[model samples]
Each structure stands twice: as structure tokens, then as C-alpha cells.
Target: VLTTFDLDEYVHAALRAGASGFLLKDARPDELLAGIRAVAGGDAVIAPALTRRLLDEFARYGSAPTDDPRVDRLTEREREILVAIGRGWTNGEIAARLVLSESTVKTHVGRVLAKTGARDRVQAVIFAYDLGLARPSVR
Candidate 1:
């Protein structure tokens, strides 16, 4: 999505709505084209600088509690995996950190997505943030 709005709320909403990319309207022509192409190619894209700002916003204003029943369905291991995903860890990274095989991580991730009714990894990350299971890390 290309828009002038770059607020965290907008970004989060767009992602939850299945947007594959978010780009400011003022972005350079080449960058805009690249973002479009990336999204068309089935790759997600977010401006790096905007992502940093968005994380800072998340850190400042943490998610509120919700009564979503899906939260109760996760196994402890699945919860941990969700947190890792929220922290932006790749499957390989999560595998190494959790000392699980990549296939195991993938299985857990799929389970988490199914249980939470999330459309994809991005939605899972949002769900993690929404439940306060994950927060932006201080860097």
C-alpha cells in the first residue's frame, strides 16, 4: 500500500488487512516501483526506517489486553515460538535459539497460525503484540 499516512496504527492496520507492503507516497520513484514489484512477487516490504519508528511506537504504547479465546489454545511451546516471531526471528534463528530443528519450528509456527486464526506470519506477529506476549526490544 502506498499512502501518505505513516503512523504505527495505520501500518498495523494495513498489515492486518493483508497488505504485502507499506510505502509512503513521497518515496522516490525507484523505491516505490521496487516496493510494488516486491509485493507483486509475493515478498513483503516495509520501509526500514518506518519499521524502526513503528517498533518504537509499539514499545511506548504496548497492546491492551483482549479476551480472544484463541490465546487460550496455544501450547507453552507455541507461545514461545509466537514470541520469537513477534521479535522478528526467522525460522532458522528461532530453531537455533530454541534448540529445535527447523522442521519442528515450522510445525509449531503453523499450529500457532491455525490456532490463532492468523492469515500469515505478519498477522501472528500482530497477534503476539496485541496479546502483550511480545514487545519491541530495546536496542
Candidate 2:
């Protein structure tokens, strides 16, 4: 369960399977506790990236999309950060583009990862692509 699935469909399947709980493989010890408690209480939990995709899929299939509080948690600044990350820009590049300090950009990236349940920038990039938050640049 500690493999590199940090953002894979298996995690969603694990939740649907009523497992005691499954962590993102990179979850900190403290975060693991929350997962255990959630499943122990018979609740299903999914990473934000997966949640977003599921909602999008539902919308695509003509069903009502699920309401996700995490989407609301994202600030306008964070949305801009995601778009930058989606563009495959390095933190330094993002800082320069947004006219923010590199350290501030790093902090924003960290917050985005935590809020989006993204294991790393790579996954966040993939999530952004999947959600159409950013288009792939011309090769």
C-alpha cells in the first residue's frame, strides 16, 4: 500500500472496497491516522484529484456533478498557481511569471499539493491536464 500510486485509480478502488483505509503512499504518519479514522467510521475518502475527475466524469456522463468542498478551498491565487504548474513551469519560472518571490511560489505549491491531495508537483501537473486547467503547450 506504500507504493508510488500517489495518484492512481487504485486508490479510488481501495476506498470503494471499504478497506480499513488507504493512504496516498506518501502520506505522513499523522495524515495516515486521519485516513484510518475515516474508514473506521465507515466513511469513504478520496484524494482531491480523484474527486475532481469523478465530478468531471459525472458531468461528462450527463449526471449531476458531485459537490466538493476542496474546490471551494482553492483561492484565486491557487488557481493561478495550478495553471503555472500545469504549464510545466518550474517554481522559479512560476515566481518570475507571477511576479512573486520564489519562496512564496514554493509555499503556494506546497499549499496546492496539500489542498489538492496531490503527492507531488508531477501529479499536480497531471491533475491539471486532466481537469483542463491548462492546455499542453505546442511541442
Candidate 3:
């Protein structure tokens, strides 16, 4: 329901205000419906275009994962989850690949979020890629 112009400000504000998810103004009806459902189910969703913009912004900022204290605090397992996130893997995919339950994967994702100080998975992925934490092989 939010426009892309204010995405960065809104996303951060929404998080502070406890809002669940975000969508671009140009989102298709079906995509909007899916986003709502995902948020209702305790998932975060980002439009592909918006995700690209976020990555661009992250790169512009030059706050790579390795330079971040929070990212440095992550365990190896959390780093693995971060790389998977960077590869655009779903929780189910990451879980299946790692031989873990979906819930366990979610836990690791949450830990990664906390440790990386990321506003969301998209930002975490950007951080991972920017810092070279995620390799091309993973992608």
C-alpha cells in the first residue's frame, strides 16, 4: 500500500511502529493479496523492484557486512543462513538444504536479522552480498 518514494523512511518507521510488511504502489492485485497473506502469516514480503532499490541503496551506503559489528557477531551457522538469504532462498528451501525444520530455519533467520542489525531479510541479503559473505556459488 506504500509508494516506493518513501519506502526507506516508511519501512523503517513501520518497523518502529510495529507494522508487519510493505508493498510498492504499483503492485498487482494478486501480489498485494499474496503480500497481505504472507504478512498475516508472520512473513515479510518485498517487491522485486523495491528489493533491487534497497540493494542499490545499501551499496551506495557502503556499510558492508564485514564492517558491521553486528554482522561480525554472527555464528557460522548464522552466516550460512545469511548466504542462503542472499541467494533468495525461501525458508523451506534453506531448511531442506540444511536438513532442518522450517521453524528451525526461521529461528536462524531471526537470529541473523538480530545479529546483522538488518531491517529485514532484503537488507540482510544486501549486507551479505556487499561484504562478500555470500558467494556466487550460493546464488
Candidate 4:
């Protein structure tokens, strides 16, 4: 987890560096605690507002999604899980929605990250968007 106000540039850098959560310094006590717990539980966390802003910024500079050979390595199930991750769904949410066990979802998520060369869940989410597997709706 990273507690910093440098969201503009460092957020992406931190995630790429394998940091699981990014929380602003001004986060409330409850939010900070939750972020830490989420990270400790092997889950990724980012403030919702920051997520939206980051997605919008990325979308502006994003390249047109094309056929990337890396994505071809994923199985159909892995691809689906990657898209779900890109949609900001938790492992529990994915498990419930896909009618699978949480452990199964975790396995698939790990596989997706491995196959795609993503360092973490955030990187996987970025990969999903970059590959056109998922599109972020900036609203």
C-alpha cells in the first residue's frame, strides 16, 4: 500500500512496481484501515474517485486496442476473468457472478496475470483495457 498524494504520476508507477493499493494521504481513518486490510488480504484497492480519474487519463492517451500476441496465451476463462477485473470486480464478485468458487477465481486471476506478464491486479486491469478486452467508461 502507498499512502501518498502523488496520484498524477506515481499511481501507475507504484502499481507497476507491484504495490497492491494506493491511498491518498488525506484518506479517512476508516478508508486507510480498509485499504491496508484489503492489501493485506491480497486484494487491490484504489479510491473510487482516483480510479475514475486514472481511467479517464489513460483512455485519453491509450492506443487503439489491437491484436496483441500476449493476450492470445490466455484461455477463454482467463480472458473472462481479466475482463471482470478490468470492470473493477472483486474476486468474490467474480466468483458469485460466474458461479465459481473464490479459490477458482483466484487461480484464474493468477493465471491471467502470469500469462499476460502483469505484475499485479492493477497491471492486469490495464492490460485488459489496453488489449481491448475491456473498455473503461469515463462518466
Using Cα atoms with residue i matched to residue i, what is each candidate's TM-score against the true structure? 0.78, 0.52, 0.65, 0.81
Comparison by TM-score, 2 against 4, better one: 4
The sequence of per-residue lDDT tens digits that candidate 2 reaches over residues 29-68 is 7766776676556443454445555444423442233455
* C-alpha-based local distance difference test score of model 2: 0.64
Model 4 C-alpha lDDT per residue in residues 1-139, reported as the tens digit of each score: 5466756678878776777888888789999899888778767788776887788867777667889877889898888999999888899999999999999999999898889888778888888777767777645
True-structure lDDT of candidate 1 = 0.83
For TM-score, candidate 1 versus 2, the one ahead is 1
Best lDDT among the predictions, by candidate number: 1
Which stretch of 10 consecutive residues in model 1 shows the poorest summed lDDT? 40-49
Ranking by TM-score: 4, 1, 3, 2
Candidate that would win on TM-score:
4
Residue 87 accuracy (lDDT) in model 2? 76
Instruction: Go through the candidates in order and give the C-alpha RMSD of each one to the true structure.
Output: 2.8, 10.0, 4.3, 2.4
| Rank list by lDDT | 1, 4, 3, 2
Which stretches in model 3 have alpha-carbon errors above 4 Å? 4-22, 40-42, 49-65, 135-139
List, residue by residue over 11-73, the lDDT tens digit for candidate 3: 555544545566777889999999889777756777766665555555566444457677669
Give lDDT: candidate 3, residue 129: 75
